[model samples]
Target: MAFSKLELFHSLILVLSVVSVQALTWTTTPFNPPAIPLAVRSPYLSAWLAQGAGAALNDVWPTFWTGSVVGWAGFVKVDGKAYSFLGAPNVPGAAFTKATQKSSQFTSTQSIFVLSAGPIDLTITFISPVEPTDLVKQSTPFAYMAVSAASTDGSPHSVQVYSDISAEWVSGDNSLTANWSTTTGNVLTHQVQLATQAVFTENNDHIQYGSAFYSTTNTVGATYQTGADVTVRAQFINNGRLPNTQDTNFRAVSNNWPVFGLAHDLGSVTSSTAPVVFSVGHLRDPAIKYIVAGGATQARSSYFWSQFSSPAALITSFLGDYANALSRARAFDSKVNIDASKISADYASVVALSIRQAMGATEITISKNSDGSFNKNDIIMFMKEISSDGNVNTVDVIFPAWPVLLYTNPALGKYLLEGLFRYQATGQYPNKWSVHDLGSSYPNALGHNDGRDEAMPVEESGNMIIMALSYAQKTGDNSHLTQYSALLDQWTQFLIEDSLIPANQISTDYFAGSLANQTNLAIKGIIGIKAMSQIAQRLGDTSKSANYSSIAASYVSQWQTLAASSSGKHVTLSYGNSASWGLTYNLYADKLLKLNLFPASVYEMQTAWYKTVAQPFGIPLDTRHTYTKSDWEIWTAGIVTDTATRDLFISSVKKWASDGLSTQPFGDWYETTNGQPEGFRARPVVGGHLALLVL
Candidate 1:
């Protein structure tokens, strides 16, 4: 974690100066929300910055907010006033790419700018103090650029500001340079001021030693004049990385992350108005901590803004609603503190982060067919499909989404189920089995891009049947069962007739590799029968219920015989190997979902699994892989009544979700071995974040 003296100084100066400038006088409008406390530790500071930029805007700095950790002091500006500029965050995977100037590490940023601020002058200044870190560690001189004027012509102006390293290389002063020019119009000039190390470290608190350069570039012979109400754009570009284009752009000059401006545009200006003057300042002050901390709000706001539209909006909105519900559930957990093990603070954050994280991996779509039967686009399940590269409706992906939707809003579950039902009922395929995922994440129900159907019939059928019944029970509504009775009949019949589960097909862990996984099949058959019975009961069809119940009873007995273990344990594997089953089979029986069809001892198997083989972060999904799934763990927990055991499950998931200061969107998977994020981000399965609601 330690860096060379020179490197340390460079980073310290960068973070402190970057953070301090924005913290001091950061302001938006209406009212300035409180800044994050400055005294927090560095790791937490990164988390806060991640959270601020990831969350939505209106939620925090309604008018404006921006958080960033540059090479120098971090900067957070909210409502036009700079808040805090602390030392920069440590980018662990920092590696210089020949193609890029900045390290390969991701730069997390968020901002809030006045989309329609009346004509006004805006300027920002930054300073750095040398107390928290060492002098050598805080001496990495930096350059910056603040927007002068951004008018909305055919092409709005882009303000480019960076440390004029060339100046330092030539003049040895590290003076900065600024460039601002509209696509068309008038021009304004400004000068740079570098704070001396002494002034930066001592008295010159507001503006000190690092050098600054000014630009006089102006757009000429423009179509629009100064009198027009042109949209004003406050832009910030992180040019530290080469291919400067790699650096994300914040549309406005506020503190909120980039997402906040997704729905709002920078304000326009008129010829009568003076050029928009953006103050460019830097500081190495201690107060930068608050601004750095505000990054969380900025993150949350940015995430909300980015995912708040049509294709991604539905999933994002659902995830947000679910996260809120999980928060509520966390509150409810306290009402009956006795069930502490059922949920916890860690669990709450996991679920909340899920909404904030996943749900961005897929695209939503709908298609009109020639037969007048509208076909809904299948939600693409993976970001990268071996067959489709990065396509949608992979059946495997839908499997994870069930727990998430089931926990929060059953209506969405129903919508998803109905889509599956449509495909099962009319798919071009011959079998009556539930179809695998319908399509890629982007093209919508366009068609399965994976090039194959569900090879694992029982697993998918079980998922569908169980989800239907679970939805009914959870929502206290049987209308869907009645409406889709025909499809239900078809699926139930398929389970009874051919769903003993065929050999060789994919399950949730297709990525880990596949097999004829009998334990997986047992779960499928047992759950499928249970769902059929539940559906019958809900529909008030006594005969059907009794029939399905009888069939399910028989299947349970068969399952027990086939999957039972030496110590009367429930362990099922296609190969009958205890070791492999112990690794692959979640031995945790869904006793609750099955209405206690099996003994609590079944759930105990999972508890044993957690106790014996679980890693510091999570239990492995199977023997073949060192990774685990957060969603499955929750689903397994939902079936358990032991609050303590369930809480443990929640803890494992939270550990992965919050592991590392990973601010790269919300990842749905994590490495069970090291507890680091594995794959996928911003996916809808984050609805699973509400798994705690099942309590």
Candidate 2:
């Protein structure tokens, strides 16, 4: 049938409309998480969209993980009519029609949103590349926001896209005066920073000493402006482009609300138009302050500093590597989805949501050379024990978070442990057992020289030994074990003495308070002894290995009698409390390391017991409370022999995640019955959710 060009265009528009209606349906699976990850790369670069009922991107502002607003806004002009797609709510002179969000979905490394603005459909993707094997890219601390617009009505239209970030991203305290400037080279950058830099300090979990960069490629039709938020956005709204001017009025962030804006003009847009990409990052030179082996505090820079000459070069490289970065991220997301879905779709969704939150808590750093360069070989990764306590490189925290690192890249686990090993090897810590954490406060890796760190003797020592061996087992690298042999032996000795009958102490679930003869704590110590046996065998100390093996065997035989309930149904929370049961997640290490320390009957018994006592969300941490830790639940699920039992545990947690009980980040601690967050949110412990895949 021959038709006129106008008739053909109308027919194509009808077909596209039908397809768009089907594609626009939201697929928020497992369910819509309480908060969606936005630009979550490192701890300081982290941002999230707090989810509310029917929450669209245009209406709600993105916030830091600490719940402080990080003023980022996006707008688009189609045929000279402005529409809001991301943040800015009320501009005095510019009244923008809010775009209708069509659909949203999150994967392991990206959050994607589709919105309709007039005749165009905009696809916004937030990509925080998780390059585990590529330290240079992974340590860059930059996240990408790529926006693409296409004609939804099968007709061409003039389009211009605008995005801006306020000075509030530089300092948490809005009253602090901010300074900003624009630079043009390979990339156009708007750098905003606090006037007064306070190194190694944080205002409400926001790094107070870094410059925040909002940058884009220096392509044709790209323009930039920095000024009062209203003035800058109003100009873009009125003219469909920025003025390419920088405001010299440096003032408090809250005074005039300064914003750095960039705009791109696409003269005519169709379905085949390319995406415009923007990069946002925070950079702090000498990112951490650490006490060295000789008890002298030294400044450490992020590993990216070793690769690039300056922050500008680093950002330029990151901007240039967008295509490769997105490819790698998509590959990673696909692998996570395929592997996790083999268990259940619910498991896949939970695992997808947890990757960024887990990796976001860590920073890889290196020592600065005397010549002002960086020494890359002296590298260590530090993690903030976030939300619960701001401790640095906490042993127990890493123990739970280690599974994800092991599943992704074993080398990361080694980097996390290196700082702790260096601190203890220097004899700075006086504790007979392993130190609890590198420092009580974050960004300051000061050793607990006073020996006043929280006492989790059996817990921390066991966690250290198990994690060290787990890293070696996964990577077939034992140099770390050989180098730290003395400290390992010392911790093994402490475990041998106190493992069987643990004294009154706290486990990682310290909020539940201390208890004597904790069955779970004792089993972890027993497993640590067995793990040390393997470590000794790998190091060629067969005599020590045999002796440790014999001791571990004897302890397990006695542990079976002392820890089991009289009904033989499950292990008790403590040695003699028959009526009190808990998730014996420590058993996962035995399975993970291929150590047959416990019999198959023990696994079956515990799996069956979990089914009987399961809560609406999942199993509780213990009989003492109705609250559960998601990390431990997944660890327990990973070790269960029954497929249905494992799925039950996975599906239950998925139910809680979709329940919208808390709008904070993916929390590890929550009440099992109602799925309410129990204080802890956005902690790296959710990395333990990767347990099923790790096995």
Candidate 3:
């Protein structure tokens, strides 16, 4: 007796699901990684595996999320045969063994892979212990790579493994004049600093130009520069310090991961089955030496480092309970994992890989008052600085990232809102149509960046009010609401006056350029006003609530009249214009918020139309083009109860991640037809993928 094909496939799926929940590991697409997110601690100390698979680790360079090369150290040895794992190919040495990636697995906080290198089987794992709830460790700039090697035939073998870091960690361009020195105190420390102390002076999409320090514990023989290129190489042998053996670089090319730089010693074992651990840590200091109203300076960087435990201490703490950390990641990832898994592995993969990288993009910053006090204000006011524009605490950025933060660590969400409120309380952000676009461009928080730039108009105003409602709904922490009531009132009035018919202006998709009569932006304003009314009711302002509620209801009525399609297929991009169309993604928020703003058919009709316009990568952002926003597409799909239509959108995302525009970090924007990313990668806004769970 045999089961049907469908039944057998279902069983396989079930088994895979169980394994997935137990271990968050999956294979990569061999040579192409679509960019593996490695160390995602903050905007500064972040790295990605951009190298193609099967290529020598040195052949490819590891980069920060900003696309800046940090350097490579692909040196691994098994039974004296050199193998490459982290850097390019082995430096033309004898008994070279090609290490092939067998499979890749990841938890929210780690990436693990099994490599096949001839007779020697190696399991390599990189762990970055980042727990959003733990502020100290969450922002700690450290990661660990653990390696386990054994022989297939149960033979005694002596093996060595090592890591070499690049000097690019210290400057934007490796050729820049750098001061290199080694400090040996409690541990072996190597430091790199540019000639000028230029910190937080620029706010572009490039990596920071500042100081960097790399260190290792219980390791011997480290190099700051072996050739023309700058590199930090350390060798540790047999779980102890390496013997007096240095990498003899016969081929010292400008760009090479030389086996000669420094060899890491992996302790010898009598049997084939032996395990050893080694770690590398990085510290990135950002900002000017003095305080700036825009926030984040050299003083703050040093202060945070002061509170942080040493790298050896932090790594020991991280690796000691490493299994538990992965377990926690499995559980946290399970929130989106289970839901997306119900769709397919493709869906689950996208969601699982995104959870940590998305959340880590927004660097967590804590400040203390002059009295050496740490309050809610001090607890947060982070830069929110992980985008191309390098914007800080912008309303739109907050809007997409809200759901996850609200659900996972609502306290952080509350803290974020307080930052916004503090800025608004200064009477700096104008609420006529919208507040400022950003507090200041990345790393700064002196004043609103919108003062120098064009206003987002309805975009910012609507986002602020709606995010406030979301914060309250998710966390039930309304104390901040009370604190921000006055500013809320001002913003609510702005919504009432212009929300019904927003002036031609920009949205969070400001990069796409401004648009007038934006139907979706109008939907944003409507939901915002309704949300404010709900908050007003919660605060016991019945009269004000009723007034605003009536105003929002009227706006909805008029919008539907002007924007609805006679065919009941989809809403137009603007009022009374059937030819132009856009994603009414914001309309789905009404369903989630239970505003009862639209009929059920409205959703069915819009979704039906969206499917028709869907490109291979995803449903287009609108009829404007085939380019789509990854988060908005997910949010729109999340409105549904089942995984039917929702799975299609998730599948599109899976295709994008697998073969998107480039093997770079995840961004909010991408070409829907070809998966070519336009802008905004590795942004925290992908946190919005939790929309369905929060709903």
TM-score of 3: 0.85
Where in model 3 is the C-alpha error above 4 Å? 1-33, 51-59, 89-97, 181-188, 202-210, 219-264, 270-281, 284-306, 309-327, 330-336, 342-344, 371-377, 381-387, 430-434, 640-642
Better of 2 and 3 by lDDT: 2
lDDT of 1: 0.39
As a TM-score, model 2 comes out at 0.95
| TM-score ranking of the models | 2, 3, 1
Model 3, residue 195: C-alpha shift (Å) = 4.2
Per residue, candidate 3 scores C-alpha lDDT tens digits across 1-695 of 89853344345444533443333223542113356766666566677876322222334677877777677565566665666666543332233445776676665566776776556667777776657677766666566666677666566666666555655665555444555454443344455555554556542343445545555443443222233222222223222223333333323122342222334454554444433444445454533122334443323442244454454455555545556765666676566567756756665676666766766655555554677543323545354547556666776777887776866677777766666676667665444544553445566655553456458767777787877777777767777668888877877787777767777777887766777778888888888888888888888899988988888888888888878766667788777777667777787668667788766766777767766666656788876677888888888887644455676677667666655237577666889766677767778887777666567
**Maximum-TM-score candidate:** 2
Clashes of each: 145, 0, 27
Candidate 3 — number of clashing residue pairs?
27
Model 3 worst lDDT run, 10 consecutive residues = 231-240
- Per-residue lDDT for 224 in model 3? 24
